[model samples]
Target: MTVRMTSARKAILEELESSKAHLTINQIHERLSGRLPSLNVSTVYRSLDFLSQNGLISISDMGVGTPVYEIMKEETHHHLVCSSCKQVIELENDLVAPFFEQIEKEKKTKVITNHLVVFGICLECKEY
Candidate 1:
């Protein structure tokens, strides 16, 4: 289905693309409210829902209180979160691809880890 692009959707997409960190719906609304004053929280939520459903964006809970959203891209990536300090580390696909390959071979099943976030203590926190 072709989703017609609206101003609200455009603003949200722009915000998601520009942001380095994933953001929650309220955070997105807050960022775009100044530029698109007519945009409301409900509109942001709905547009995000539509975009996420269309695979244009991704929504995930990265061991945080609220779920966050980011634009989906061709290159797959994963996150390693420090449970103690709440620090997030981005992991390249190459690093975990081999592990997933072994798992698939052993289990005889395809692994879907699009939103995988492995939680653990970082080195510094672990040493402390």
Candidate 2:
């Protein structure tokens, strides 16, 4: 069954669903103003926390100290964070899967790992 959403919640969901990059609360607040002029920071955060708990979306720290959120459309993915620019890039799990499998085999480990995070400077920041 599909759950119905309140206007405030729907507004938040639309912003995330339409975006490609993960967005911090500030970004969301700004984007929402165009349509949801009555939106406030507290409501945005509260609804986000609820949605995250309900599996509607996922939140990750983009190394900017502010939590960024993305639409959870796919399996858990990894990220590349820029130290200088604070840029976030979403990447599929393929890059690190082989190495992780090798490690698990070497250690005779059967651990259930779901999420992986990788941090590094993006190419734009590297050129500086």
Candidate 3:
């Protein structure tokens, strides 16, 4: 299958690649509207959905009200979100590989995910 990379897709990809935090569709639209001037929320949403379906980007529901989007990376990592302060901590996939393996072995099903978001109270939040 062939995919045409539209201007909206290009702008959204750039925004995701440069961002440190996962952004919602609205956030991406808001960030690019000034530059594109004609970009709309529905276009951004469609582009994001297409990219995600093609595995070009990763999407997660970081327990926030909205689903967030990020560019796909070589090293897969998971987020350790502080339930109290909502601080996000990036953790290597290796830390949870064994758990996934165990689940697959016991359940006889393949486990697949680009990223994982786990919630917990951080030390700073706990101390507060």
Higher-ranked by TM-score: 1 or 3: 3
> Model 3: what TM-score?
0.86
- Quote each prediction's TM-score: 0.82, 0.69, 0.86
Best by lDDT: 3
Looking at candidate 2, the ten consecutive residues that score lowest on lDDT are: 110-119
**Per-prediction tally of clashes:** 0, 0, 0
Ten contiguous residues with the weakest lDDT in model 1? 111-120
**Candidate 2 residue pairs that clash:** none
What's the true lDDT of residue 1 in model 1? Answer: 75
- Is candidate 2 or 3 superior in lDDT? 3
What lDDT tens digits, residue by residue, belong to model 2 across residues 22-116?
Answer: 78999999999889888899999998988787678778766778888887767767777677786667667787678678988999886344345
List the candidates ranked by lDDT, beginning with the highest. 3, 1, 2
Q: RMSD for each model, in Å, please?
A: 2.4, 4.2, 2.0
- Candidate order by TM-score, decreasing, is 3, 1, 2
Per-residue lDDT of 43-86 in model 3, one digit per residue for the tens? 88899999988888888988788999989888778889987889
Computed on alpha carbons, the lDDT of every model, listed in order, comes to: 0.86, 0.78, 0.87
Residue-level lDDT of model 1, residues 87-128, one tens digit each, is 999989888899899999999999865656789999999897
* TM-score attained by model 2: 0.69
